[model samples]
Target: MKIISEKCKKCLVCIDACPVKAISKKGEEVTINGDICLECGCCASSCPNNAIEYE
Candidate 1:
């Protein structure tokens, strides 16, 4: 799944939840490349800050 940056707090919740380690930090933003995302909702649901969401 892809994430909406506006809703993201850069909390890193999605970063830790990704089993494939696809999440990454870019400056103050948490970014996930769709190519490596695997379409798993794990990161989205794990985000306590609601930083990640489905595309």
Candidate 2:
């Protein structure tokens, strides 16, 4: 999973949707701790701004 460009609006939609609560905000950006991420793709689907990308 990766964050797209610089379009993240810090909406926190991805953070709330994450079942493991793996998404975290630092400054104006959000990041997912890979170790805690379950690769469930829930965050990607939930992001309204299409900021999260899973591969």
Candidate 3:
């Protein structure tokens, strides 16, 4: 999965939706830890801004 930073609103919606807790936030920056990500597309689906994309 990938995060389109331009499209991200930093809402952290995807973080709540991530089952693996792979998403994290620092200040206004949100990121997905690839090593912990399950790639289940849960984050992608939950992104209201369509910031997360899955392969």
Candidate 4:
């Protein structure tokens, strides 16, 4: 999964939706921890800004 930074609104919605707690935030930036991520698309689905992508 990846975050499309240009589209991200920093809402933290993806962080709350991650089932494995793979998402993290630093300041206004959000990132997914690839090693811990399940790639379940939970965060992607929850993001209102469509910032998270699964590939």
Candidate 5:
């Protein structure tokens, strides 16, 4: 599974890249709901800042 790190810039790109819609934004913070995530790696691949990582 992957998680968003402190390096995130709130671009919200990962949210859109996630095929399972597991990535979410609450205020300025973006998060990935592991239970709903498909672990397809799309969010990590689309993250321009390399904020998403395997944990």
Candidate 6:
């Protein structure tokens, strides 16, 4: 899953929605740590702005 910065509103919902705790905020950018990500699309679903893309 990748976060689209243009679409992201910094809601921080994806951070809490991640089951593996892979999502984090850094310097105003909400990012998903690929190392801990499960690719379950949890963060993608939680994003109201459609900023998270899971491929």
- Model 1 CA deviation exceeding 4 Å by range: none
- Expressed as tens digits, the lDDT of each residue in 1-55 for candidate 2 is 8877486888898989999999999887799889989999999999999988885
- lDDT per residue for candidate 3 within 7-47, as digits (tens), equals 99998888899898999997677888999998899998889
Q: Report lDDT per candidate.
A: 0.80, 0.88, 0.88, 0.92, 0.83, 0.91
Residue runs of model 2 more than 4 Å from their true location after superposition: none
Top-TM-score structure, candidate number: 6
| Model 3 TM-score relative to the real fold | 0.89
Superposed Cα RMSD, model 5: 1.3
lDDT, candidate 5, 1-55, per-residue tens: 5554578988899888988889899777888898998788888889999888887
Best of the two (3, 6) by lDDT = 6
Location of the lowest summed lDDT over 10 successive residues in candidate 5: 1-10
Clashing pairs in 1: none
Q: Write the per-residue lDDT of candidate 6 for residues 21-40, one digit (tens) a residue.
A: 99889998998899989999
Write down the worst ten-residue block by lDDT for model 6: 46-55
For all predicted structures, in order, the TM-scores are 0.80, 0.89, 0.89, 0.92, 0.87, 0.94
Q: What is the lDDT of residue 17 in candidate 2?
A: 96
Runs with alpha carbons beyond 4 Å of true place in candidate 3 = none
Better TM-score candidate (2, 4): 4
